[model samples]
Target: MAVLHPRVAPRRSTTRATTWWGKAWVRAVEEAAFSESDLVTARTLARGGHVGQITTRPGGFFASVEDQHGLWTVDGAIPELDETGTETVVEAVAAEAGRIAALLGGDLPHDLVEHTDEAGVELLPFGSELAATCTCEAWAEPCVHALAVLQQLAWLIEADPMVLLQLRGLAREDLLGRLHARRESPVSDDERDLDAAVEAALYAARLLDDPLS
Candidate 1:
């Protein structure tokens, strides 16, 4: 599990998610929300520092949020991929050297997601696929508190797409382990060389970007 401190308020902006995957997360919850007013209020709560520390783990996240009523606990979950689904996603990632390189470099490859989706493993949640329950007595399936937590979650996702992968059931280490095992399986020397080259390129790019590091 990882803990995320409350976000410092940012300058006014209409955009909540800057990354493609982060935007997809927000869209999922927005489509599930029944009340537009709640969404508006939730956005305000999320941006104004009404939300407290958030805790995340495989398949779920929770946080404390304050509204007009009071402070409330919000727990949200996106269903984890089953064992078969996990393997399918892993296989998809392992098959593409670029996907592994991108992930190692803290980037999510769009084509990797497309491949997984084509393989029937929806890496990103959709609609009510993301569900939440709040301690607030609100009748809405996802009260303002829950929505606020989710909106904050999108901010975290923007910084690290791996958050989505973990929420979907595969942690970073576990995913990498599976990929390593697949690579260790019977394969041609050329394939190994290609994987090594991709990793070398990623490392070189990082050094060039921040020589001080």
Candidate 2:
């Protein structure tokens, strides 16, 4: 014979719902193009927390979270991946965004915020948009769901943060740094010689047109 208590089942369900990883997975799938489910699988990674607020701006979107660490922007795009890996997926997205920016010949949209004290590590757009902010000292960094989202982002960043960057039309490389590097590697002396030859011809014309002559 078996006996089941009426309250026991609901409590178990509630417990499962509130578990750190459980909540995170729920939040993560909710952000993506996937349906909610009880099972945790490759498609159902965890999200750290809920989105606090989201506002659409003229060209893009703006979001805010209450996590202790801020976002950090890196200096360049991530390298390509070997297969259809998560990292590869993110880098592909970023590369597309950069291509779009280049086609438009306009400034790519981007923002860099310090979500944490770590160097070159950032909260990233996916994490920022999906994980809501919190002022509490839960020490989860983000809440459970946020932690899940962060885990997913970790996977994503391991492959490519540039995918996040591309969404904003900014690549991982700094525009100024690229410009500086270009300046430092200008055309060689052979090109300068060609320019001097052209300048000499122009000067000869100027001499021929002297007023005294």
Best lDDT goes to which candidate? 1
TM-score of each: 0.84, 0.23
Model 2, 69-165: lDDT tens digits are 5532111112222223323333322333243233223222232122121233332333234423334344432343333333333333333333334
Q: Among all windows of ten consecutive residues in candidate 2, which has the lowest summed lDDT?
A: 1-10
lDDT of 1 by residue, 14-73 (tens): 637877888888998799787899899889888887888888788888888887778899
Q: Candidate 2: misplaced stretches above 4 Å? A: 1-141, 161-170, 173-184, 187-213
Q: Candidate 1, which segments miss by more than 4 Å at Cα?
A: 1-11, 185-190, 193-213
